[model samples]
Target chain A: MTDHRPDAGQPVTAVGEVRAGGSPDGGRLDYGGPWRRVSRKYVGVVVAESIVTGVVLAGISLFFALVIGAWFGWWMLGASVLVTVVLLVVAPRRARAIGFQLRDDDLLFRQGIMFFRIVAVPYGRMQLIDINRGPLARVLGLSDLKFVTAAASTGVSIPGLPAAEADKLRDRLVALAESRRSGL
Target chain B: MSEAGGGGAQRPVAPAAVRRAVEQLTDGKWHRLHWASPLLKGGIAFIAILAFVLANLRERLVELVIGQTGGPAGPGGGGRGGGGGGDAGRTFNGDPISAIYETGFTGVAILIVIGVLLLAVALFAVAWRMHSFRIGADAVEVRSGVVFRHNRQARLDRIQGIHITRPLFARLFGAARIELNVAGQDAKVELSYLGSRQVDELRRELLRRASGVQRAEAAAAVVAATTRSSAPLSAAGTSAGVVGAAPAATTSSPAEQSREAGILNRRVQELLGPELDLDAAPPESVVKISPLRLIGSLVVSEFTLVLLLVVAALFFSTFVLHRYFILFLLLPSVLGSLGYYVRRFSKAARYSIAATSDGVRVGFGLLSTSNDTLPPGRIHAIEVTQPILWRPMGWWMIRINRAGHASGRGGSSAPHTLLLPVGRLADVEKVLALLLPGLAGADTQGLVMEGLVARGRAASGFSRAPRRAQWLRPFSWGRTGLARTDDAVLLRTGFFWRRLTVLPLARLQSVRVSQGPVRRMLDIAELHFNTIAGPVRAELGVIDRRAAVAVFTEVSAAAVEALRADGSHRWAS
Candidate 1:
């Protein structure tokens, strides 16, 4: 966990040692808490979605190839299979890459494996905090949290949190947002 | 201070008197727009159609002109008289009025014309009556739409700015249109065809109410307004930056008072009316862009450079390479785009920026002029840039991000984001002082100048992108850097277009750090300071990952602190 921190052991880091807080949502939002990753079940949901997409794509290719020739069908079938395999292999790590931390003034979210992105959205600047659950994620008891600011480019989303944790996070964020609401 | 100078006789209306005058207009009852509302509303299309019909009827005018030469001698004489001999069938088969008689429909046509005129007049009268508005305490409500009614009320607190535009037709009628620029997309409430005289007072009254000025503050604001207005006007004719001469305005004697008023009136006239009807500005404007400079700058601008390259290519292929057909195809479009930009720039030919009591007033246009008053603290970000050719000329363009722009690429309408089209570096500094008063600190002012003009490796104090990042921006890596003041963060970027963006900390919504596989390998990251959407993209492309993390932390904390301290929303309070 210490290795995950950038500039580790450096005093420039305002992010202090992670510790647990004894509250409903406070534990996850604790200033001292370790950065929280989305639920592991999210990997299953992602794999399920990838399978649906892969099957649809291959189905279309198979239809075209059957109408035309087996040669075209073989090429498209091979490509679709390759894509599905890559997505299936990468789903778990991609799910693992997503994490968030609550600081003194803001909530920091980080994601991506190949292209890393981290955003710090001050509580006061938050215009909207939404919780959405996909059909597969719902069945897996996982949810996604999203934040909107005045800037459209600040499209920050934390995907695949446990359903219960998501509600806790929502309540905590809404409270913090209300107390510090400032400029739009 | 005004009282101490015995300047009360010349002092403009005081707060109580001014409020009393405003109260007459804001009586909280529905008031109809100007009498010419319907004509201004529907008359534009009507006039266009009339012009089209007259153009198609040019044959009749020619016939009348040549009719005297053995043609019809009298108004009613013509028709099968087979007049004008050979030319009879071609055009003046006689007068059009006489043709109506020959066709046996003169009485019917006359009746129809009278009937249509009556109906139009009746309709306009009703619309003028129905289209009414009410100015209440907390909100301004407008009601209209005749058969299908619409009632919209904009809250006083939400009024972002006030815009008054005088179209050529409206100006001919001595009327102006006012748009209440509310703080949302398509949220503008428009009141059109108000008497030009009424518009100034109405705009001031609305802005005053929107400012949330209380009775006490209103009095003090009047004095401050006088002081500020005098400073800019006096600064115009004297050595610049006489910003702190507020006290001097109070100590003037009766003799000096009259002289100042004369200069004030003369300066105002010069601002409003310049010798070249197209370009108007105070004589001492640091960069008074004349029509010649405007065209000259366009010739050297990047757009023209691209155009010249394409034309040269066409010439080469047509003459040397013998590809003649290609030239014919590309030449027209190249010429068309050149014409388009020329027209676009000229529509805003008469550009001027001045300090008004309500806010900074930016005016633009040629035949039809428009003015917008941007209230203080509404500007989210400021961007100053110089295209490569403009650098040596010391010409720069300034743009700012506000809550929302009511117009989309409004060509003849106001160019919404454009603060200064073209001006000298000194003009940019003066405009910045007016727009962002918090930059008054000498340290921040110095930082801004360094960001604006310092190019090449100058050893400026900004945190420069490292040498390793040269691969990312081969030519511009040396020029890109980030600096911060207590109130804002400045990110300077680009090579040919040398750009600087200032994002006030209070307006920041979020901070972001991004790194791709290549950037991660190089141990560098890009930092983004998310502000309200506008032309200025505030981002630091590649910096040390550790520095990115540190600055990200600092900005987040500082932005929150700035938000807590911000009181500019209700500036009057």
Candidate 2:
């Protein structure tokens, strides 16, 4: 209120001078942002999926009416269209809210649009952690982290991390897990 | 530049080489080839797609038909003109117009279309999602995601063997498929589209990595064991640094570090075999059956099936062809041949054998490669098994007792080990070098004789206690108080092959005591060694309850003491 902007007589601070990011002493921090966004890239898959769904339902609706004369088919077709439209509109925002947290000891993730879910994987249990960037994911400057453990038949997956961050996390996680397993 | 100078300059590039090697090893383009079998996979996809298209078309047709027919105009009358108009004017419920609307066929048609369509979409999505894979450091990870994405990651350590093959077309395309037989994991990891050179490099890197880790761990364990055993002599003069989690000893020393690496590699190799018949008659012995003998055995063993097939073919002729009764005989032979081929294929495989300071590594397998590394110190006990067949062949199989065995059962089937199958006395000595280094120079024949003597003692009247236990013996005719053991009962049943079993009290999960009326009356007792091997338990029976109790108590106490010592050592090391 009293001269918010620094004058020549007072000490002036640059915008960049303020500690902006997080724990600037270089300690690990959980940096999260909205992950799911309907970009031009993912739209193709979404549209294809929706159309496939619509067509299949329409066929079933006709067949039942023609043969057994069931009433559920028409409802199913209408529901499919409604669901596809809702998902297409709402999915991006939901995905954006979902993200992961990293700590020295564990990698944690929280996802799901309607029903929230949180999964925490201890470093010691991680058999392997890889950061993969597919052709599309690479172009979009995003990466997915795959956390594999020996406990499950198939390894666990954590998607939608920044590519650079994902790689750093992968290396640190592997080193920590292996070291902990050896009781080091 | 001098060679040394050139090499010095390349030292900085060494890490890059390692990264490149990792990249090369993990670049498994072969998984794409799995889609080639799309006959089954692709057929399902095609069906799903067809259903989708058909459903769409059906819905449109039904909607159009219903819209035209269900109109308020006289049913069929206005739409088709003259004849149809007259039919539409004819009776419809009570009124011609309302009857057509009341039938509900229009609504039913719409329902059927939607139902089929949803199912088709779900099926397609599931199939597409399931066809995913990832390349990893140790093995390939493949998973399918839909409703529940099936995920499986194989350990390169347990890969027992590998097979590199190319179909006619694959060969022309300069790509080969690699099939790995990994143990522990049920499913195999197939890499289908790798180049020949890549396959070679991949195989070598995996092998090298596995062996390197195995050798290192074995060496460290051996050193530790040796130090533990020998340091007792100098315990008073100097602290062995093995007490109370000493800071220096607890932190992994240079030697221990190397040994740990070796063990890891060995573990990777063992994880590679998938077709490993855990139930197969021991892996140490490689049985060779000549092709002629193999065929002869097949014919002789399956004589009944063959005869049935022949009779059916002769009498039924066209009926047999239509019914496929001949397939029964053919199927067995084909399966048997395949099994035989698998075994034979394994025999020809070469595995790098290493003896480290800690343990011994026996790596073998092609399609399902595996490396088993056993640290001598970790072995609680050793048992030599002689199957009825092996008895005639003068072959013995040695198995070790250990903890945390995946085998849920106890005893012979308790997931112990198969050390040797058909080794001579000298081979046994060679193996004992790593298994029981302290006894490397000990007499193998003498030990065998000692085992035979022990068996005899059990089967005969070696030690007779009080007269109360005579009836407890299997067929004891002698009138004695404390009866002799089973070794005395089976003295006359000696054969060429002797089975010597050593049960370490430390690995014993429990000691179970059972007694019948005769046993109670004669004061006889039976003690069972409960281990992790499922179903097949090891039991030692005797005619004297007192003797049994003493042995049981002593073994149990010893095991507990050893375990406590091991725990402390683990903490200290």
Candidate 3:
């Protein structure tokens, strides 16, 4: 696979002629790309998961067909196809919406389309920020940045970001939140 | 309302002495809740064994019945085979009565004797365990346990409030169970086992003690006030110059006199609920119901049901009603009458605003009694609630909101006192004056009230969503958006029906951020604000994740500052 990122060159169309956001001026970028155009590092993992899930399901169906009957096997195959299609359609859109902007005093997140909402996470209350990349996300070249607070364990997550971006966000948020909490 | 502590070392502290304290424990007489743990396990075990025995012997039992009845069975069948009712005997053979008697009449008699003996013993133990209570001047002690004893002690100072309830049976016995809400404790101390005479005696003693404490505190406060005035006068002369003493004394005396007059005015004002019209009692026609007529109608209406029931029963039975039947119906009627008597409208049920050392003690109770000892310095915020029905009556319930020792909903329940249950607008203002001492000086009443009204109206605009969450519309209307302003966070949305709740950053407990599949699908995040006490839970309804997080960070810092300020007060004192 070829890497599209050219550190020294001009901004290019990311993937499939889809401009996630921003003009030639790089004014205010909006909308993330389809997760297929996901970071190259995670592509292998996603393909491996897909192949493993498909093979296991197919093996189970074939065994049942031989032991029981053909009707059950066909039904199992149909159900698996329907579920796979649904997940494939939803995953990219979910990945695309997950992004965060780190500001000096607070963190900003723009999410949702219909009832559009923006959350401002201030530094003082930002207890911790953790970066994690799962198997599917790794294949997609994506990672999640989580913001934890002292009030509860269920923290906020921003998904579909590049791994390096996630790490940088975590470092900055932790420092700012710590300084604010310490009254510095 | 008043409780006296017996401080003397020689005072007898025994189980009987703690009777008053136990009565104050809860709203009902203390009966040991049957130690059901052991009994429940025993019952389950007994049922299981019985089921197992029957299941295992099912085939054998059928064969035995067939043989006994001589129903075409083999060699064991000795009785008549062709008898018409022979099959009935097969089923009846397993009956417990026959099984015991088959051994001999002695076995059956022994079973009955054992049953009666166990019942008699159980009844005695129950009575013995429940009748015990200990009372003392400072605290009431209760020791109750059947096999293993547990003791509960309640202090007078920890008594937040009292509630007296007379269930039907207790009413006939002329008994009332006193329930005391102990501060910083889950176990409510109750004194239920007292008879009418004992309850009356205990109640009298508690009231006398409470009043004595108040009187002593009042006297001390008066001396303090006199001494404080002299010291201030001297201090002003020395600090500001002797020439300025005359002006200082003149201003101080008038201010003090006006304050004293205000207290007297408020005490009188409480006699008329919040909505009193000083101009005149609304024209007689407008008053709706006259006091005399209301009283007369209530009295005449009483006991009509009982009288009618008795007459109807006599007519139906042709005066041949069983003697026991009459006695049975009389018990409930008599008990109901006693409850009605105790709960009847009385002058004593009216409101009273007693002068206290720090502020004023306003006490009231219909059946559930409450006494609020509000010190102005400790007051946090004031709220006025107008129930839709009270609009016609022109009454508003004023509440004082404060922090610290807010017991009830675990650690989260905030402390609040309902100062005016039914009072006019002016009365609400007067309460506000005492609760928020600097309100008049700052002239912020109009601004604060207007701000609250505006906020209340704006709350209706908050978004509340539809029921079904579809795959297409990942973000439900239930989500609320918040904007972080400089001083406060602006929240707008109504979940379904409209209501608004606002909290200052200083009062926020913590901030929460959450993301789910639907949130990710819609490219939205959520931020939640947790408060110590309020109707809405902070996180669930929040829609604007980014704004919420920003607000969270800011409020977290502010909350820390407020806590520090609260801590500093201890040092200042």
TM-score of candidate 1's A chain against the true A chain: 0.77
- Regions of model 2 farther than 4 Å from truth: A1-184, B1-359, B365-368, B374-381, B388-393, B400-417, B436-449, B452-497, B534-536, B567-572
Evaluated at residue B469, the lDDT of candidate 3 is: 26
Cα shift from native, residue B474, model 2 (Å):
5.9
Question: Model 2, A22-53: lDDT tens per residue?
Answer: 33323111223222221233333334445666
lDDT of 3 by residue, B71-125 (tens): 6533222233222222323433665433443444645577776998689568655
Off by over 4 Å in 3: A1-184, B1-141, B146-148, B153-178, B182-186, B192-424, B430-447, B453-550, B564-573
lDDT of 1 by residue, B216-239 (tens): 244555445435444433433222
Ten-residue segment with the worst summed lDDT in candidate 1 chain B?
Answer: B1-10
lDDT of each: 0.68, 0.42, 0.42
- What is the C-alpha DockQ of each candidate? 0.32, 0.01, 0.08
Whole-model lDDT, model 1: 0.68
In the range A87-175, model 1's lDDT, one tens digit per residue, is 89999888877778766677888787778677888888888888999998889988889988878888889888777777877777888
Q: Which docking category, incorrect, acceptable, medium or high, applies to candidate 1?
A: acceptable
